[model samples]
Target: MKTGTVVGRLWASKRLPELPAGALIEVQLDHPRDVIVCYDPMGCGEGERVLITIGAPAAWWFLPGQQRVVVDALIIGSLDEGSPPTMPK
Candidate 1:
């Protein structure tokens, strides 16, 4: 799992049918200044701190040995008012 913050949202009305129905948000990964579009079903929004599971781990983390590439990424959770206790300074 990776820690990040929602930087913005993307609107793609046309996509593959295999994709899940959710918001495609741009998240600023905690490490580098890089931003990535992540699928969010948890309703996270801009400026909201979030937990993201990327690639394959994001899939198998669920169950039944799901393919990580197919279910490549997800916004797992959103943080409230405080900084995450486990987050580095």
Candidate 2:
């Protein structure tokens, strides 16, 4: 899991048939220019700070029997309290 900011949303009228309902959010990773697009199960909107969990052994949990429906980041929840957690930059 990691902390990231919701930069934008990807609107796809047509997607994979097996892929479940969710939103694709653009997030800036822990590294510079490391921004990436991730499939989030949570209904997180733009500009919202969120915690993301990478798809792993849990990949089948969401996209079963298929490795193509990769969701490297999932929004766990929204941060409504203090500022976003920090790291050693």
Candidate 3:
């Protein structure tokens, strides 16, 4: 899992049938400061802080029962408004 802010949204006219119902969003990672695209089934909007899952977990878990997606990244949850918790050193 990773923490990030939704920076933007993407539009696609065509997509795979296996892809679930959702919109593509761009997230700016808090740690490495890199941008990535994620599938959003929770209807996330721009500027919302979100939790993302990648790789196999994203493809397998973040969907309805017995269904799989082809996404590399998926938005799992949205964060509440406030400063994020500090990491222990």
For lDDT, the strongest prediction is 3
Model 1 Cα lDDT, one tens digit per residue, 1-89 = 77888889998788775565668899988876589888787888678999888887666654663232355778888876786436455
Q: List candidate 2 stretches off by more than 4 Å.
A: 63-69
Where is model 1 more than 4 Å wrong at Cα?
60-69, 84-89
lDDT string for model 2 (53-76, tens) is 675643655644565654556677
Question: What TM-score does prediction 3 earn?
Answer: 0.81
Worst 10 residues of 1 by lDDT: 61-70
> lDDT tens digits, residues 1-89, model 3?
89999899988878887776678999999877899999897999888989999898888774576475678898999998895735647
User: What TM-score would you give candidate 2 relative to the actual structure?
Assistant: 0.70
- Runs in model 3 deviating more than 4 A are 62-68, 84-89
Query: How much lDDT does each candidate structure score?
Result: 0.76, 0.69, 0.84
Report clash pairs, candidate 1: 56-68
- Ranking of all candidate structures by their TM-score, best first: 3, 1, 2
